[model samples]
Target: MQASNSPSLTRSQLATELGVSVFTLNQWAVSGKGPKAIRVGRQSVYRREDIDAYKATISSTESTPAPVSQPIGSYMMRLPEVLSLSGLSKSSIYAMSKAGEFPASVKLGSRAVGWPSHMVMQWLNDRMGNVA
Candidate 1:
């Protein structure tokens, strides 16, 4: 791991900067599609230069950078918002999640949980048949 004083972005920070989800970053890391990260104890951190290089490579191949899928505030949604968006009640949501029919909630604390907005949106999009 690089020195803590060195410039680096934690996985969550990089996900925010790149307008993606931490879950997405994890998938990218596993598939070797995202910027290289250094393991720092139990967490991963991306060096500033590595992120810049990754951005450059992406820009070179794509006409334009990808747009942010969701607003910063909506990156994670509490139960209520998820319920409203999906038009499902709390019990139904929990049931569906348990059955693998819904995106599972991320644990925010001992009693708090949230769903990644991107995943929920993707699920909705899939159900809607990619409707605009």
Candidate 2:
């Protein structure tokens, strides 16, 4: 990982890296259900560093995620990404979402869902520790 200070991704950019439809990401943002994002004149931009920090945290769980030598940012995640990251399932994720226990989904179009990658990760972190 290169030592830098700045976000490497726009909202659209991060979605592509994570392999999810853009509609999903937008939905997450609109609903206030994704990672902390900056609203730049009607656009959301996710910081690369934030994503990396989140990954580093999840990887250090008590169960200790399996060692995979991939750059943290290289693994952008979506709903399926969240399931795979925490070893949860689709139904479980939805249930949690409904209960407002997990990151909420943004509303994209009439029927689309997306979660903020960082928000999901941060939720995991707060779960792992007494985060403020």
Candidate 3:
């Protein structure tokens, strides 16, 4: 049964509306991990209003910075990794780094910088020993 009042979308149509690749939408559907969808054989269908509702539900989530995953054997650590291993918030990390109280990050490229792994590890060990 179709609802005449609400607009609906095919997989490609919804992917275009969301500005994501069709494969991504398909993966989401297959994994049951994204906007609600109906699967009829290989085809997936979505309601425009449902997509909008899904967007609203996720609108309040905090946007984590890029490079959320740590690279294996990475010589340098990005902000996410530092926070995970150091138990410090973004603001505290930056404030301490600026104040020269924490290990400073090194320039990796024109727009990217990271902390040396050894230095961060040393800082962690030092912190553990010093804290009461």
lDDT of 2 by residue, 7-124 (tens): 5667767676656778887887778654557767877777776667655765575485686464455433556678877677899888998998888776655755667676787889
- Give lDDT tens digits, candidate 1, residues 96-122: 999999999989999999998988998
Model 1 earns a TM-score of 0.44
Models ranked on TM-score: 3, 1, 2
Tens digits of per-residue lDDT for model 3 on 1-120?
A: 233244777887777767799999879877876689977788778877788887887776747769645445648889899999999998998899999999988888999989988789
Alpha-carbon deviation at 122 in model 3, angstroms: 2.0
Q: Higher TM-score: candidate 1 or 2? A: 1
Backbone clashes in model 2, listed as residue pairs: 24-113, 24-114, 27-106, 27-107, 28-106, 35-119
Error of 1 at 44 (Å): 0.3
Alpha carbon lDDT of residue 59, candidate 3?
Answer: 76
Q: Score each candidate by Cα lDDT.
A: 0.89, 0.69, 0.82
Off by over 4 Å in 1: 1-6, 64-132
